[model samples]
Target: MSVKHDWYQSEAKVVITVLLRNAAEKHYAVEISGQRVHMTADDYELDLLLLHPIVPERSSHKAYSTKVEITLAKETGVRWEALEKPAAAAAAAAPPKAQAKNWDKLVSEEEKVEEKEAKGEAALNNLFKKIYSSSSPEVQKAMNKSFSESGGTVLSTNWGEVSKEKVTVKPPEGTEFREWDK
Candidate 1:
């Protein structure tokens, strides 16, 4: 069930005020983790993945007859744009030209895939993505054509070589690749 709630943040804390009448300790429950908040009052529920990290150990909630107020101590003094992280993430997805994601220290899409130390298939994929992203237009086109025409069995960055001929699928040893039936 939907319950009305108001959230605000100060330099030191984030406050969530749930409008729930007859709010009691037994009926209303609030749980605070590192950056997550889960509150329940009878049939109503409120969950928030906070925009910023909060000191869960120092957080607390008070229940009153008309409302239940939760106070979460902020780990840092950063003001939040939204009560939940998802809202903040969506807003950050399309950042302003000059203004970037420093507000949240959020990682870029490319950064998310490029790990510091990758291994095996992950490393290969990351390498391919990196190579493709940084390659010249000709190289990119060559790579795309080769990879696709070869059924993902070939990935070539040499435009001169790849453009000369159609890439034939090179199946791995012990594996057979057959054409799909019409």
Candidate 2:
């Protein structure tokens, strides 16, 4: 049979209740350390690393006919922010990967590959945002209007000096312009 646990916090202590139906006091063993808790019986074991520091001397447990109730003293008399660190962080910090399941391989391998591809797409989108913000007001207006319409394709603008006829030096009075050979 599997053991289930429920955790609750109060002003000064944290309470954990473990369901061990019809269990006697002799069949259970409980150990509480600075931030760790270990409880075991003939059929099951439970080990927990608390989120915050607790006073081990003040922690106690009592086993009843159907359950075991454990009370742990909070070091600072404050509520915990989280029950435990994230699974990924704990798995990375611990020496062994064996403690955590290889969920990526268990699920679809195709989705993992797709998620990596999506990161690249996200980077490209960020680049577009940068370019859009740096563009001129006229360009921004045109872009906004096009986006509001069905679709926008091209940006046309005169970026350089207007075209004009090339100027030539006037020939001396009454002298014809002569082409010179190299």
Clashes of each: 0, 0
**Using lDDT as the measure, which candidate wins?**
1
Lowest lDDT sum, 10 consecutive residues, model 2, at 157-166
- In candidate 2 the C-alpha lDDT for residue 81 amounts to 64
Candidate 1 lDDT, 1-182, residue by residue in tens: 65677777889998888888987843878889987777776777766666778999999999888888899999999878877666556455332211113433455645665666678998888888989998899999999999999999998889999998899999999999999883
Off by over 4 Å in 2: 92-182
**Candidate 2, 137: how far from true, in Å?**
38
Pairs of residues clashing in candidate 2: none
lDDT score, candidate 1: 0.79
* Poorly placed runs, candidate 1 (over 4 Å): 87-182
Local lDDT at 138 for model 1: 96
Per-residue CA lDDT of model 2 for 41-160, tens digit only, reads 887677666678889999999988889999999999777765445566455443321132344576657655554576676865655565677888765655454443312233322222
> Global lDDT for candidate 2?
0.66
